[model samples]
Target chain A: MMSGSGDPAGLDATTLNCHELGLSFGGHKVLNGFSVTFAGAGITAVVGPNGAGKTTLFNVITGFIQPDSGECFLGDKQLTGRRPHSIARLGIGRTFQDVRFIARLSVIDNLLLASNAVSGPTGIGLRAFLSEKRIREEHSDRCAEVLETIGLTQKAGDTASTLSFGQQKLLSIGCCLMNPRKYYLLDEPFAGVHPELVVTITETLKKMSKSSEVIFIEHDFEIIEKIAERVVAIHQGHLIVDGPPDQVFDTDSVLEAFVG
Target chain B: MEYVLHILMLIVIYSVLAYSLDFIVGHGGLVSLAQAGFFGIGAYAAALLSLKFGLSLPTVFLASICLTALMSLFVSVPSFYLQDDYFVVVTFCFQMIVFSIFNNWLEVTRGALGIPGIPLPVLFGWEISSKSEFIVLGLLILAFSALCIWGLTRGAFGRILHGLREDEVYTESLGWNVRAVKIIAFAVSAVLAGLAGSLYGFYVAYIDPTYFTVMESILILSIVIVGGAGSFAGPVIGASVLVLMPEALRFIGFTPSLAGNMRELVYGLLLVLILLFRPQGIAGKYDFTQSKGAR
Candidate 1:
């Protein structure tokens, strides 16, 4: 494995910035005038209490939910109100908090599906049919590499539903790894994970953060402290703290929000 | 010899219908009940064009595919928003609408009295009026269709279809246009069914509203489920067994009246047994319900 400090300079260094993002669900405000800028490299943790709009933030950023009034940008590229797949094609890889996957597909097949650049809607014409074997082999090689990185090489042929919950979570992250996106949005990658697998996943993410920007929403402070160099915390639909891990965790308002 | 050729020809036509249904039901996880509507559209279009307009076989075939694909949009558009049960209901309604049009539109469809004396195509100045000669043409089309379906399902498009079947939302997040996938798959299936319909019209030299019904759609669905919905051999195997079983019953000393009812009974019994013993189908990879009890 390569070192995690290789200047983090493979993808485009386009920072994901949100400006005055506001949203409400039937009069209950989820995110009110939320704004933050995420670095194009390194691990940035988004932490928040329940109903603090952390999930909503990721949804809006990923184009799953259109904010009431605000805009998101990757450098100068406008992202607001775009479809999820459009945003994904625009270089954003995201994993769901619930660890959703194509359960019927094989473990390696899931990874193969992730690489949209290489695996999207190939033609069924004469030439395409002739080159299918080569295409499949190339994708299989990439999937094998991803399976090895995720420590799931043994289960490559198994259906995804047969994998345990934590393994499914790793497989989900492995799917994201197959794509070379500018930003990675992982929602609660650590939640409900076994400690040993957590260590494996954490190391995998750390390695990935070196080449691409990794933005993850997490609850475990220990995990956030271990991987997150910068922390952006939200409280009740607002950005209450944004700084280094030590400073953000030590803030009185963050402590109050957690306790009171 | 002619009787056997006739049975085999019907098997080939139904195989096309079964596999077409598999594309939507098995790959896309959509249970469309309007397949017979598309099938009816193809047969009527082919029959009318060949008889009234004197169009060649190629023209009628292309027209049939185009017409059925256009009609398939009625089902595919709703699938974008409706959930499972509701989607089935919508297809059922569409099937009824098409059936009513076939039965009532006396000007074009001739209502219950389907178009007769539908002529077979003459190729290379040779009239393919014999059953054996028609079987050759049928097998060639079947082989071409099977090859195309194989090429399609083995590629990236097929993988995306599998993803749509499992989890559509996750597929969208992977940079796939889920709506477009569903619509394309539905159209492909409709076109295939339409091709089969045109072939059936030409083969029998007749067309009728009674041949295309919701029950026909369910029969094709059973072929997919019994033979293995997602598996390549499933539709072919299912279609062969289903088409031959009724013919076999007649040879076993049962009268034609009893044999007809017996065939339906056997189909129901076989389906129940398959669901109980092998819910994943004969060669299927997916468990449709995915329940613990099924495993």
Candidate 2:
């Protein structure tokens, strides 16, 4: 958490509190009594092995899946069972584990689609259609910055499908950053990313965490240790360890889950 | 010369139809079979408004647009909830329903008797009765409609549609009201189709239930498939091929009676070849088989 514990931006404490979230698919339990309170603004790394419910927790919190029994709150707003778009509008921007931005659009267009003007109250309709030139100018600078941060400035006009897997992964993150949100849930943000650009993405995410709460699901602990202030590790649909990265890594259960 | 102009006029009208259908199919990512239904609604609305009310051409166009757009809501609202094949089914059902209404509503529509004596379009006291004048009027209408469609779909709005087509969840996560955008896309698409229909009614001055069946819907879709769907020029090119190429058979040593049968034969054969070679379309960026057809 590069922002520290100060909350110095004079921001109110908006937390994503998932209480007693239990989800079962068929006879298997994906998240059993998965509850956690993400308070304050900072970067938190959600670490877990495959099928340990890390992504499922994000899916539940983001309204893609309804928990059999649970309630999720983003500050005073209830997020559980709401439409994904409504939750996003409520300021929870997220990236999928497998990137899903529009491949047909130009690389820059993907970010532009997420611009504030595109997300305004009038929506992607007549008003925006009528004032597209002005709307495009309103956020071209920000789109440029995100593209530059993701190191894809030169490839702005190329179709997204032309990009390599890693660049597309970075574009996915770039798309998320284009729209300002209070909370960002990135599932494996650095997956398929080049080593050097991973640092670049980390810096960007770290910078964003200064004002917004950034939670990521990553398996690489070295990168997690570098960026994450708090690490919440889950195993077998339960929270095994949750504390500072050093302590959570030292926990025997966390080690056992990853190793076994 | 006049015959060529006639073919060109038909091409322009079909081009308009393809362009609007492209919005829903190419950008919106929903294959709708209800475009001809909306087209029929516009044609019927225009015929009745002009024949009965004595309204001017512009007013008739406006009324047709409103009526057709309203009718599109019946398809779009449900389409927002349906996915992929189910959505296509809904549009297919909507097409059948529109045809039924046109066929069974005998008193108002005159059943199979058809509406005749649709007046020539008049704008600012210029009667567009000649083939040349009708072609000019069609061009102007096409220009206006294409300009509006271009404006509405050039920037973020178009990208949002592409996003919605690609992945609704990803589009929703970007904070767009996917449902609302999709519904509006349908309205815009139908309005343009309605405009085409109005031009169609005034051009022919005669229309019947048979002209607006599910088969007609399939023809419009074939134009899109042969021409291409996603690109701006794809549908226009598609319309030209599907309209003019078949007609060319009449001039190329084929008797008038033989040309009619040959036209249908060539139309079907041409469509098959185009799809086999170019499933994405002649110039379309989207590969329908990969994204749409295979599903």
Candidate 3:
């Protein structure tokens, strides 16, 4: 594993800055001139109503969809109109609004799949078998570590489809841990999770914040208040407010957007 | 002895085809039904080069791979945008088109008569004229194909392919080039199928449009599904069952025609049972249910 210098400034910080990011579906604009700058590191919660285009923002950042006329930047890398996997390889890892666990695969295998990004494309059959002693040991060790962190060590061998909804959510996060990235884009990580698991997730995010930036979208403001250092509130495809969690929540416009 | 060697050679050739298809359907989650089209292109390329142009074996083989890969690009264009059932339909159309060309294009494909009397592969100065030698050649190709697949699956690229299989949308967010990876995988798989097809054409000493039909594609798919998908041993197991099933049917005291039907029946029965009970097949770690709703 190649370790970079530990200096926070020296480390290439991933900044997802959107300038006039707009997207239209069938002519009606879903996101109209939406813009926000997520800087450095720490958890930045994107809080909004059900249809505020939060997930769509994550999509545009990750290059899943093209913006009509705007730009997205990851650190110094201009990420506009690139492929999603290429964006992911550029140090951005994202979860889904719907937990996208490979339902047929074992939980550990799912994690192993994520870990492949670190190893690259040469690790398949015979070579994997020939180097099995060391590779398997490393994979097992890492998988054990992440699974234990997510409290899913016991369910490592279980098929993903067989797990409870909360466990499945944890496993999805666990998969992301196999390959450590600079930026994490989590879509509703707290959804369907139990209270205890939610605490575990919050702690995991807190730990992750020290080394990497986390931008997560969530409806539960309580959880957001617990983990988020900053919040960006969106309303109908626009950034209505951006600041620390307390101030953003106390704003009259945010209250009106939610209430009215 | 010659007949045995021929059968063995065919097995090795089909094993490569089956392995290539496994990458698309098994790992990439694209149940492509166009292996036969690519296979036909390979056979036609090799046959044309050797029979008409009088090219060497190695040259023919390389040309076959290139031609098949080029044709695969067309399949990839539409299939890349679609997934699962829609992708299958696109590939199926390509298969039909390839077959039609082979059957109707009299000037080039000989109108299904199949260029006959293909000579045995010859090295620099050595002529590999015997059937056993041909079997050895086929086995070597099969070994190479297996190694390639094994290497691919264990690498980062292979994992990305699996991730695409799991959830392509999520995979995109991980900074992986989903479209590029899909196209590369599809093209590589087509090349492998082409190699197998070229080898099969040479070993059989005859070529015909009927051999490259949709049924042939189904047989290759069945081999992958029955053995298992997404595992190294799956294709090997699938190929062995397909090869041996017919031999096993001979003990049932039926005529050759009846035996053929019985063998196919058995194959279908086995596939159905596996899909019903063990949807993941023998060595597969993941079940088919994931692919069921993946679109």
Candidate 4:
């Protein structure tokens, strides 16, 4: 592999920003005046109790959910009101709270599904056969790197259905890891994962943070305190805490949001 | 020899149709009942453009492919936003509408009178007049269709179809235009269906509304289900088994009309048995009864 200091795709320079994002699910007010900005090549943890709109914020930023009133941006590009795929193409990588993948697909095939090397909706019909070999070759290096990162190199050929839950979770995360995006929006990346794999995933996120922005919705405070340089806490669809990890943890409102 | 050649040519032609539908159903995890419509459209295009306008085979195929692909967007774009079963209903309607056109558009289609004497054009200086010659042409088209579909399913485009087949939203989050991919799947399948339709008309030297109905679409889908879907060998095997099995009834000493009725009964039973015992078809890796992404 050619040596590089950061993201091979050079996605580290951009920041993710959302302003006054408002949304409601049947007047439930999932997000109300929610706003946040994340810059630089470092990991930021977004923590909240259930229904606090942490995941909803990620969805809005990623364009999976449209906010009632707001705007989002990636560096300089407008993201709000755009399609999920277009927002993703704007350099935002997102994962779901409930992991989704084809159970029958091989681990490698699942990862390759998200690979940038593959062209989509090629209209040339019968002529697409000619470029198949070249596309396969171009995608090989990234696949190897992702397989190694998720520690599934040996199980690359195995069907994902056969994997354990933790392994499956890692496989889902590995989908986002397949392509290079400026910001990775992971929803509960550590939930239900084995401690051992969590440690491995932590190292991977850390390594990734040096080259790309890692913004994840996490619940566990121990890992958050250890790894997150910054933390944003939301409760009842409003931001309650935003600061260094230690400061946010010490805030009484942060405890009130969780305890109440 | 001519009769056997005729049966063999029909298999090759319908194999292209089977492969086309499999690309949408098995690969994209979509259910479309409009293959017969596109097929009929292709046949009509070929019959009308050739007998009326005297177009060449290449031009006829190209025009049919383009026209069918365009018409497919009418169903694909709107129906894809709905659920799977709703999409099927849309295709069913599309099939009905096409059948209606073939039956009632007397000025253009000659309605129920049908179009006959569809000429098989000369290709590369070869005048294809005999059933054996027609088989050669059908095999060439089948081979090309197989290669293109095989390449599509094995490549990244296939990966998109497979992934979206599993999880449309998840696939979208990966930055792929999942809707576009689904539409493309329909268009490409329709393209091949149109090609097969054109060839079928030419080979039979006849066309009518009765030839393309909702039942014909079901038959094509049955072929995919019986032969297996989602595998390169599945549709080809399916087409061979489904086509050849019905003809086997002809030698059972029953009268022609009795044998014809017997063939339909057997086709229905075979599908039921396949669904009950071997849901994946003889060569298919996918179970059609299972909901998308379940496997």
Candidate 5:
């Protein structure tokens, strides 16, 4: 566990810190020496072009893909090589770029499944069933609340596959509400969504950022401009710019890299 | 009539097998090819206990379930790290290994000759010798299995498995241990298959290495696929169709060998047609697109 370093740039008590992370697939280097410090409560947008390793960053941070080297910390806990579920249990939630959902299950069931992890016991067995009857009621209530917040209450009973692309993305976010983490890694949340839903998502992220830290990867500079307090720019697996949104946007080298 | 009772018994037993596979292949999206191995382990365990040790049927059946559960740990541990074709290959190897044991362990299993004279199920000191009594026993077992399946799919455990089947990465991100859930699902599936095997051994009163071959595993897989994989009624429908098809073929007036070959051809044709035209099967709302990799 690494915590409470007095340096101003150090990670906060409820933040995620990655140091010297590296990864390679087959013979290609996807990430190398990637390091960033996310604070406790703000939106840190990972703005980059396609193939910039943004999703890779999320995968590494969430423990889906182990880095060749370097360590990650959530709060005081060292989460270098932990399993994804363990990282999630430590209060880190994530959404995929492709918007993965249990398509056969209803929207409500998807949220209910997520809620079970937070509301139910940790282990699998008779204990999970015997805990109490009230837990079920609590789970249903929480699922309803999240669905309403995402404006998906009307489609709660519908299968997730039947929802519009924008609604599906919102449902994906709502699924994470069952166990709201202190850190969120949202991978291209607005990739294919409509402009109206974009505003709704931005507002939702703003509200989420008030209580938790958000590390999102977005291609849309407009959305980045509206939501990002800080932006880290990557080009071809290398970090080129990192600072305030306007400052990074103003850099001549970043503009050149984007154009070239 | 006795033959009809025997077929009904097999339907009940195979229904359990098909439903159990539904969990791994249907819900977890792991297409295991080792179910017959677990099934054989149950049958042989019961057969060995009854013939050699003269144990009662109920005691032997319970012991058979425990044995298969322990065997499941061996496959489940390795399966946690493998997926898709590799997982299928490993399970295929396991099925071969179980079959080999059945054929080579002469002292215990009597090799291919198998163990015979297994006592019929006796409940409350009444031997179920008559066909009606056996049918009653089979129906009761089917009812209990149906209850178990219903309880599992409706509960929190089933929800987690469904999530894993749909999108394992998303499930993992939601704080669910994907591997552990998969292992549990596999184990439960094995336990049910083992129960079916135990019942099968007692009902047939004969056990042999030939009964637990890879072809048998394929037959079980076909039943799951043709009936609909994830739905509760899928296995029952699939098992009934598969079990009754061969019997219905008796009226074709072909030689025994030709009839057997035709039955196999029909099974193959049905499987291919289902895969091509209706991958969802009869009752399934979800297609095979939610397979393990899709997750």
Candidate 6:
């Protein structure tokens, strides 16, 4: 098994840990008993070739898919069998690789969809209706703050579909930033982005990692080195290398599999 | 004057139904064919309560809402396990089942014989029997329903529904209990639809299963589609156009036999034209064909 020996339980109690995770479709195994513990905070990039199960790993972690057999833990909480919304309520924010957002809605409304307290039945009744304006204003204020952080403050009132691809990507990330959480799973934030916007996003991720765990998937090594303090390299559903960017990127097989 | 008031009253009732349908279809993106079933349930429920129990209009209204809300679960539960066409199929089946009950359950609904002499609604000791008086009552109810829908669509809740429509997976990832939100939206829609049906029963002073058939459901769906899905004014505008268009046809040179067919022909033509010219609807932003991969 091409697995790393990093013991997340031994290191930090708040770290996200997965134990012997295995998942398969028919006879094809996508995640072959993969195991790794993410850093408690800071940006960690999961770099691997296409079809290496990076997205599947994200799916399992975010409760979109249940592993065949294994346990996932975030701190003391068991997240393996929880629903996606339950996982989200536990402070795990997620962004899609496609930058999925309500395009017909304005940028502010899109961000407000992920705003806090809109979860559960509390946001559905007469009481919710009474305070809806206040809540909207509050969320809009926070969205404005997030848009400023992501350099989308000028386009707050603009519809999401009208935004450029890079701006949409930034908006997707800004949505995750609406309510501060302990962990953020950003799937391929740098994909199809320009180099300048990539720098902007990298800086945003760096700032985000200051107080929360920002685990991202990226194919670009340069951006990975700049943004990712820790790197976990996966090949064929197994973690081939896991360490600092300097150590992990220097691995012979990882370098060959990626660049070569 | 009386005829115009009657048409305006009908507009109010249909506007309520259109708004309710829009909540589920336009905002939640669930093309439910079961709305007519809930509407039928409300109508039958109100009619029976009014006839058998001799309850007040307000009591019958409450009962209808509660009953139809519970019935909405029949479709909402299927939504969790099904997607797109399958979800619509399930709703279609539920709609048929409800219509069958209304048609075949002669013991309660009176079947083809139909229920007659449903008394005018008495609100706070005032009988709303006259056309003008009923119009006032319908307007009040319309205003209330409009207010509730406005409240729902203007806040974080509305945004979440839009999110569900846009991408259920993404909305789920954002900590929204997608199933619960959709179920609640369906229930709220059913409640309003039920209220409209109850009002229809009291206003018409009679009702038959024919009034709440799958065809009626299609008409309500058309109102949502023709008006606009997400826009607040879409349903009201759609209801006004559809209800008044047929009446306006009477003023035109067409004979009675040709006019009825002409109204339908015009309706179909208008919908086709709207599809060609403005696929998102007059006030809507969502294009039906463009819903896929739009995230």
Error of 3 at B50 (Å): 2.3
Candidate 4 at residue B173, lDDT? Answer: 86
DockQ values of all predictions: 0.34, 0.44, 0.30, 0.42, 0.48, 0.52
Worst 10 residues of 2 chain A by lDDT: A2-11
Best by DockQ: 6
lDDT (C-alpha, whole model) for all candidates:
0.83, 0.83, 0.79, 0.83, 0.80, 0.83
Clashes of 3: 22
Task: Give the Cα error of residue B34 in candidate 5, in Å.
Answer: 1.5
| Model 5 CAPRI rating | acceptable
Model with the higher lDDT, candidate 2 or 5: 2
Q: Is the docking of candidate 4 incorrect, acceptable, medium or high quality?
A: acceptable
Q: List, residue by residue over B1-295, the lDDT tens digit for candidate 4.
A: 8778878987898899999999988888888899999999999999999999888888888999999999889778865577688889988999999999999999999999999888877776687788888888888889988987987888778877887778888888888877777778888899999999988888888999999999999999999999988988988888888788768887778788998888789989999999999998898888877877784
| TM-score, structure 3 vs. true | 0.85
lDDT of 2 by residue, B1-295 (tens): 9888988999999989988898888877889899899899989988888999999998998898788878888988997688989989999999998888888898888878889999988988998899989888989878877786777678667777878888888888888888888878899989989899889999999999898998788889888888887777888898998788767786698988998788778878877887788887887877777763211
| Native contacts kept, each candidate | 0.41, 0.59, 0.42, 0.59, 0.55, 0.61
Instruction: Give a tens-digit lDDT track for model 3, residues A1-260.
Output: 11111222332446556778889888877788887776658888999988888998988988878899888776667788777766777777888888886676678777866765544442222322334345556788888889888889888888787988888888778777777788788999998788988988988888777878888998888888888988888898888888888998999999998888
For candidate 6, the share of real interface contacts preserved is 0.61
Cα distance off (Å), candidate 5, residue A195: 0.9
Interface RMSD of each: 4.8, 3.6, 4.8, 3.5, 3.2, 2.7
Rank order by DockQ, top first?
6, 5, 2, 4, 1, 3
Query: Could you tell me which residue pairs clash in candidate 6?
Result: none
Per-residue alpha-carbon lDDT of candidate 5 for residues B1-295, written as tens digits (9 for 90 to 100): 8787788887888888998788788766778889998989888887878777878877887798778878888788887787678988999999999999999999999998988888777777989888778777767777877777777776677778778777777777888877778767778889888888887888789999999999999999888898898888998999999999887887778788898999999999988898899998877645774454342
Candidate 3 at residue B131, lDDT? 79
List ranges where model 5 is wrong by over 4 Å.
A1-12, A119-136, A236-238, B289-295
Q: Which stretches of candidate 3 lie over 4 Å from their true place?
A: A1-14, A26-28, A104-108, A118-164, A177-180, B1-3, B244-270, B282-286, B289-295
